[model samples]
Target chain A: MTYGLFSKFPAQPGKGDDLADFLLEAAELLERDPACIQYVVSGSDEPDVVWVFEVWTDQAAHDASSEPEDIRTLIQRAMPLIAGTPEQTQLVIHGGKGLPS
Target chain B: MTYGLFSKFPAQPGKGDDLADFLLEAAELLERDPACIQYVVSGSDEPDVVWVFEVWTDQAAHDASSEPEDIRTLIQRAMPLIAGTPEQTQLVIHGGKGLPS
Candidate 1:
C-alpha cells in the first residue's frame, strides 16, 4: 500500500520565503529516494504557511527515509524557521494519478 | 500562478468506503475540467479520514470550476457523507513538478 503524509508548517513572521526555500531544497533530496513517489512543497495563500504532500511506497519506506543523515539535517535546519509545531497526518493511499500500481 | 487546495474529510462511522467512492467519482468529474491540474483523492491510515490534494491553473480557474453544474452536483452528493466540516487550506503554489510554468 502507498503511504502518504500531509503536513502543515506555519513559518515564523517574515520567514515564509526562507521556509519555502528550505523545503524546495529538501524536495530535491527526496527526489533521489527511489521509494518517494511524490514530495510536493507548496506555499499557501496565507503567506506564512507551507504545505507538504508526500507519497511513499509504504510506511517502512517513509520511516527509512527519515533515518537518513541528509534528511535529518534538513529537518534540523527547518526547525528554527517554523512558527510552531507542525500538524501532520498519516495516510494510506487508495489510488492516485502519480502512484505506480 | 498555480492554485492549490488541500482538504481533509473525516467520514462518519462506517461511511469511509462510501465517502471514498464519492470522491473517486468526483475525481473523474474534475478530470474533464481543463483548468484542473491534479485532483487526487486518497484514503488514510485512520480509515475514517480522506485527503484531497488539488492543483489548478489559477485562482480564477478554481473559482470558475465551482460554478459548474456538475461540480455543484458532486458537492451536494458529498456533503452528507462527510462527518464534520472539512479543513481546507488555500495555497499559492511556488513550484511543483507536475505544474506547468
Candidate 2:
C-alpha cells in the first residue's frame, strides 16, 4: 500500500521562511531516493506554518528515509526554528492524478 | 506557479468510509479535467477525518474546478455526510517530484 503523510511545521516567530528553506533542502535530498514518490513542500496562508505532503512507496520506506546522517543533521539544524511540536496525519493514499496507478 | 490546498473533512461517526467513497468519486470526475494536476484523497489515522491534497496548474484553475455542475452537485452530496465545517490550508507550491518543473 502507498503511504502518505501530511505534516505541519509551526516555525518560531519570523522564522517561517527559514523552516521552509530547510524543508526544501530535504526535498532535494529525497529526490534521489526512489522510495519517495512525492515530497511537496508548501507555504500556507498562515505565515508561521509550513506544510509538507509526502507520498512514499510504503511505511517502511518512509521510516528509513530519516535514518541517513545527512538527513539527521538537517533535522537538528531545523529544530531551533520550530515553534511547537509538529503535527502529522498518517494516511493511506487512494490514488488520483499524478500518482502511479 | 502551481497552486495547492490541503483540506480536512470530518465525517459524522460511521460515515468516514462513505465520505472517502464520495471523494474517490470526485477523483474520477476530476480525471478528465486538464487543469487538475493532482487531487489526492486519503484516509487518515483519525477514523473520522478525510484529507485531500490538491495541486493545480494555478489558483484560477483550482477555483474554477468546482464551477462545473457535476462537481457542484457532488459537493452537495458530500455535505450531508460531513460532521462539521471542513478546514482548508491554502498553499503556494514551490516544486517537487511528480510536479511539472
Candidate 3:
C-alpha cells in the first residue's frame, strides 16, 4: 500500500520562502531513494504558509526516510522558521496519475 | 509552470467511502488529458475527511477539466455527501519526484 503525508507549515511572517527552500532541499535529499515516490513542495496564495505532499512505498519507507543525518539537520534548521506547530495528516493513497498502476 | 490544488472534504458520517469513490471517478475523467499531471485521492486516519491533491500543466488546464459534462455530474453527486463547504487551496508547484523536470 502506498503511504502519504500531507503537511501544512505556517511559517514565521516573511519566512515562507525560506521554509519552502529548505523543504526543496529536503526533497532533493529523497530524490535518490527509490522508496520515496513523491515529495512535492508547494507555496500557496497565503503568504506565510507552505504545503508538502509526500507519497512513499509504504509507512515504513516514510518512517525510515527521515532517519538520515542530513535530513535531520534540515529539519533542525527548518524548525526555527516555523511560526507554530505544523499540521500533518497520514494518508492511504487510493490511486492516481504518477503512481504505479 | 505547474499548478496544483489541495482540497479537504469532510464527509457525512460513514460517507467517506462514497466521497472518495466519487473523487476517484473524477480522477479517471482526467486520465487522458495530457495537461492533467497528477490527481491523487487519499483517505486519512481521520475517518471523515478525504484529501485531494492535483497538479496540472497550468491553472487553465485544471479549470477546463471540470467543464466536461461527466466531471460536472460527478461533482454534483459528490457535493451532497460532503458535510460542509470543502476547503480548497490554490498552489504553486515548486518541484519534486514524479513531476516533470
Candidate 4:
C-alpha cells in the first residue's frame, strides 16, 4: 500500500484539541471524496497535537485529491493550530497487520 | 516531493512513550540510511499512539526502505504497546509549510 503518516503540534498549548477537531472534520470531508481510499484523523491528549494517516491506490489518485481549493483552506485554518511545522514521513509499512481489531 | 503520513497504536495504553522512543530511534537509524530523505517520529498525549511522517525522492527509494527485516521488528516490538492496529494513510501534502522553527 502507498501509505504515510504525519503529526503536528498546535502553535499554542490549548489549541491542540481544536486542531484535532478540525482535522477530524477534514477527514470526514476527505473520505467522501472518491480519490481517498482511506483516511483517518486523530488528536493527541497533549491538547496541542494531531495526526493524519492516509492511503491511496496510487500517486495520481492521491495527487488529485490534493488539488482542490478547499484543501488549501483546510490547511490554512490549521496553521495557527500548529506549534511548529508538522513532521512528515513517507513509509514502507512492512510489518502492519489487521487494523482496529 | 512524494510524501505520505501514517500512525500506529500500540495495542495497550501507557505505551505511547515507549512506542515514540522506538520510532524515534528507528528514525535516527533510517535517516542514516542512504534512501531516506526526511523522516520524523512523534508521540501523542494519549499513550500507545504514535505518528510517522516521511518524505522520499520517489517510490523506488521508499520501496527500498520498506524491504528491511528490521522494519518488521520495529513494528512488532511496538505491538503490545498499542491498543489495537494502527491506522495508515496516503496523502498529498497541499499546504504544509516550514518544519521546525
Candidate 5:
C-alpha cells in the first residue's frame, strides 16, 4: 500500500526563504533514498505556507524513514519557522487509475 | 473524519501569481462555511507549489462541498500552474488527545 502524510507549516515572519531552503534539502534527502517512491514538496503560490505529499512503497518503508532521529530533528528545526501549528494525516493509498502514474 | 486532497501543479512560469490568488479565494469560500472544521492553505517555501490541508466535519459535508460545479472549474483552471500533478489521501479522524482542540 502507498502510505501518505500531509504536513503543513504556517508562515513565519522573515524565515520564509530560510524555511524554503530547509524543505528543499529535506525533499532532496528523501528523494535520494531508495525507499521513497513518491515524495512531493510544495508550498502555497501566494502565502507563506509549506505542504509535503509523501508516498512510500509500503508501510515498512514509511516506518523506517520516519523512525530516523535525524529526520525527527529536521522537523523540529523547521517548526519555529512556521506561523501556525502544522497538521497532518496518514492513509492507505487506495488507488488512482486515470491519474498519472 | 478529515477528508484531504493534495494537488500539485507544475509551475507555468508566469502564471504563478494568478494561480495563488485563485486558490486563496477558493479557500476563503470553504472557510466561510460551517462544515469546514479545519482549513489550511500554504505554498512551498522555495518552488512554485500549492498545498491545501482541509478537515471537514464529516464525509457527507465533504462530499457536498466537492459536488459543486464552480469548485471543479476552479481546480481545472489552477491545474496549469502546477509544476507537477497533485496527490492526496484521506482518513478517519481517529483521535488526537495531546494536540490542542
Candidate 6:
C-alpha cells in the first residue's frame, strides 16, 4: 500500500522563502531514497504557507526516511521558520496516475 | 510551469464511502484529459475526509477542466455528500518528482 502525506507549513512573517528553500533542498535528499515515490514541495496562493505532498512505498519506508540524519538536519533548519504547528493528513493511495499501477 | 491543487473534503457522517467512491470515479474521468498531468484521490486517516492532489499542465488546463459538463456533473453528485466547506490550496509547482522537468 502506498503511504501518502499532505502537510501544510505556515511560515512566520517574511520567512516563507526560507521554508520553501529548505523544503526544496530536502527534496534532493528524498530523491536519493528509493522508497520515496514522489515528493512535491509547493508554494501556495497564501504567501506564508508551504505545502508538501509525498508518497512512500509504505509506512516503514516513511518512518525510515525520518530517521536519517539529513532529514533531521533539514527539519531543524525549517522548524524556526514555521509560524505554527503543521497541519497534516495521512492517506492510503487507492490509485493514481503517478504511482506504479 | 505546473499548477497544483490540494483539496480536502470532509464527508458527512456515514457518507465517507460515498465521497471516496465519487472521487475514485472522478479520477477515471480526469485520466482522459491530456492537460491533467496527475490526479490522485485518497482516503485519509480521518474516516470522513478525502484528499485530492492534482497537477495540471497550466492554470488554463485546470480552468478548462472545471468548465466541462462531466466534471460539473461529478461536482453536483459530490456536493450532497460533503459535510462542510472544502479546504483548498492552490500552488505553482516549482519542481516535483512526478511532474515533467
Supply fnat for every model shown: 0.43, 0.75, 0.81, 0.00, 0.00, 0.73
- Please give the lDDT score for candidate 1: 0.80
How would the candidate models be sorted by DockQ, starting from the highest?
A: 3, 2, 6, 1, 4, 5
What is the DockQ (computed on Cα atoms) for candidate 4?
Answer: 0.04
List candidate 1 segments past 4 Å from native. Answer: A97-101, B45-47, B67-70, B97-101
lDDT (Cα, tens digit) per residue for candidate 6, span B1-101: 78999888899998988898888888788878888888888887688888889988898998888677988999898999999998988888777565556
Superposition error at B46 for model 2 (Å): 1.7
lDDT of 4 by residue, B40-67 (tens): 5545444445666555555567667756
- Candidate 3 on A1-101: residue-level lDDT in tens? 89999899999999999999999999999998999989999998889899999999999999998899999999999999999988998899998676767
Indicate the fraction of true inter-chain contacts that candidate 3 also forms.
0.81
The residue-level lDDT of candidate 4 at B46 comes to 42
Model 6's DockQ score = 0.66
Q: Lowest-lDDT window of 10 residues in candidate 2 chain A? A: A92-101
TM-score of 6: 0.86
| Model 1 chain A weakest lDDT span, ten residues long | A92-101
lDDT, candidate 4, at A34: 57
Tell me which of candidates 1 and 2 scores higher on DockQ: 2
* RMSD to the hidden true structure, all candidates: 2.5, 1.7, 1.7, 14.9, 16.8, 2.2
Model 3 off-target regions past 4 Å?
Answer: none
What are the per-residue Cα lDDT tens digits for candidate 3 across B1-101? Answer: 78999888999999998899888888888888899989999998888888999999999999889888888888888889999988998999998676867
Q: DockQ of all candidates, in order?
A: 0.49, 0.74, 0.78, 0.04, 0.04, 0.66
Q: How far does residue B72 in candidate 3 sit from its true spot (Å)? A: 2.1
Worst 10 residues of 3 chain A by lDDT: A92-101
Give the TM-scores of the predictions, in the order they appear: 0.84, 0.91, 0.91, 0.44, 0.44, 0.86
What is candidate 4's lDDT per residue for A1-101, written digit by digit as tens?
Answer: 54444444444777766776667666666756755544545443344556665555545676677567887788788777777867754443322221211
Model 3: DockQ vs. true structure: 0.78
